[model samples]
Target: MTTGSATLSAATRRSVLLLSFATFASMAAQRICDAMLPELSRTFSVSLAQAAQVVSVFAVVYGLAQLFYGPLGDRRSKFGIVTFATLSCCAGSLMSAFAVSLDMLVLARVMVALGAAAIIPLSMAWIGDTVAYELRQETLARVGLGTTLGIVCGQLVGGLLSDTLGWRWAFGLMTLLFGVVGSLLFIDRRRQQAERLPTTNTEPVVRPGFVAQALIIITGPWSRIVLGVAFVEGAAGFGVLAIWASHLHQALGLSLSAAGAIVALFGLGGMLYMVVARQLIRRLGEQGLTLLGGSLMGLSALVLGFTPHWLLSLPACLLAGFGFFMFHNTMQTNATQMAPKARGTGVSLFASALFMGQSVGVLLAAGLVDRIGSGAVIALGGGVLVSIGIFFARALRRREELMRLQ
Candidate 1:
């Protein structure tokens, strides 16, 4: 597609919306297990720690699966891969709802994660293919509404389903959602294939070998830097956020549901950014947004770390959410362009680095939280995030200058 300021075609808009819904389902599946750990423990007569393996296993599988999907997306139809993945998610969710043991549940979750892995990064690659760089950020922000809402709703929906209907019903609901969305996307894919087959004006397809594409992304200095920063950003930023609910409950005696609601405010803040994305880009640009985002996140972390009352977490979470998306969205825009020839592989590696970073950060936090306390750990994360923002902002400036010179 050509880069232009023209309005998005109706079909493109529909595809984005459908992909957004698919993303929502995927994200919701990721978090739904968090609120249901106690239930899982009870159902299987296992320790809470043992039950937590469901979440851990899913994350590991999800992160690793991105490596396969990234190169496959480059060679196959991006939409086709995403649709098949969604069907896999639906099957996995159904299996989870009927799992007979903790081991079975864990296996089912791994299947779900395997499928969920492809939706976001590949959808992002699709956006990169169809949208212009200048307009891509806004398009991404708009699409982010689905993801943000999914994050916000996941805990609530999971908790509610677990409490009222039973945790199994939660998975059943997801199974239904995945089935519906997957069917719609499958139909859309058929339509796209039909439209393209008759066209003599179809664009030439690039089929770079998987190993070659991977090498292209890994060998580039700029791409390596982008991936590295994404890894650290995930670790330092999301790692702290991960423990917020536990900290609130342990430190301030807030109920689990209340603490989760406070964390959901972070998603609300992201939604706020999407509403004003166009104007924000015009006013702040990428570098300014990065600086502002990091500062806000650092401030929010400090606030959360030291707050005497639980209410303070409300605004703190909001600031952190807004800051995260500003910084993250900027990184995402850069990742899409880092290796335009191998955009899918580049973005997939970026995502893999990010998830791996989150896993590392969580491990580190788990080790330190007992000794230093959650408050100190969060404060440290804030400091690191600020440093990252500063470094990346300067790097982006240098990158822009180099491009202009070229």
Candidate 2:
């Protein structure tokens, strides 16, 4: 490759790495809260419901922020906006460490979520700006490694710290990491600003016609499909996993360490998929890969739901992880490509869909588990996921065929 191309590639890699690390750190901090919540509730003398507001509010804020961050990123320097938001996350984490009451902790969680909400979608948008569509899926899988890796570390580290040092220390350590990362990013942003020579008579881009833009993106035919697919994907594996963590502990009477280790294995499975999804995507194309991904996830979920054995669950978790990423990576790539002008917005919507689906799934799983037990609830979710996957796969295939015919 030429020098300029090589330099561009290197710069892109650096930026993507930074973005991914930020995601890793943010996700780590957020997820640790779940493990730490029981301790926090006891310490603060609050009910579980009150303490859970920390998670609920954070999730809501995280989803809503994506709607704004997209347009915001479009109008400004993605690096600057992302860095600023991440710093906010650092501040929130620090505050969470020192929170004196349940309400205070919930507020801090919201702040952290708001800050973290920008990282992934902005990263995808920036990548879309820099990378071609042909390579975007694989590139995205690499970036998504942060999501799985962070989850693995968070479950492991958070459980250890909470068990030994106390839950507060887990939050404190995460706070420190976020602070250090934010400082580095702040310095990088300053350097980039200094290097960019100013140009005169620029219009200074701003969000244009917010209502109309929102309508156009949200009302498109593909938007529903994209949103539905995202919802099913999130509700399928992510929701199931969240419930699975607790189920393993309650039903099997496993210790925290054992449960965390099993959960971490799911991350390992995801990492494997990340390594290979791009190559597979190239060979299978988006439609074929998505179909395979969905089927595997459905089958895996079914296996886990029915087996009731820890060893059996592990393989199922691996398959679910692999399928989840394949489907997820394709949707993300398509989201970015759906709108060239508002790539960030499209991606943010995609993120919103996925998270919203997870939220719905969590609620549904909770209700279903109460009525029918965790095993049956999980199996039902798996069946629902399979149905959604089949619908999307067929649609994508038909679309491809029509394009060819035309």
Error of 1 at 195 (Å): 3.3
Judging by TM-score against the true structure, name the best candidate.
1
User: Candidate 2: deviation at residue 358, Å?
Assistant: 2.0
The true-versus-predicted C-alpha distance at residue 251 of model 2, in Å, is: 0.9
lDDT scores in order: 0.79, 0.71
| Clash count in backbone of candidate 2 | 0
lDDT of 1 at 70: 88
Show model 1 residue runs off by greater than 4 Å.
Answer: 37-51, 162-164, 197-206, 400-406
> What lDDT tens digits, residue by residue, belong to model 2 across residues 1-406?
0112222355466666777777778768656755554555678887544555665566667778888887877777777777888777877887887888888888888888888888878878777766665666777787889877877777766656666877667778877777777777777778667765222113233466555556667776666577668877777656555566555655676665566667666677778888887578878887877788788878887787777578888888778777877777778877776556666777788787776776666666766776788778778877877787778777676654433332
Evaluated with lDDT, which candidate comes out highest?
1
For model 1, residues 266-324, the per-residue Cα lDDT tens digits are: 77888788788789998999999999999999999999988999889999988888988
For candidate 1, the clash count comes to 0
TM-score of each: 0.91, 0.88
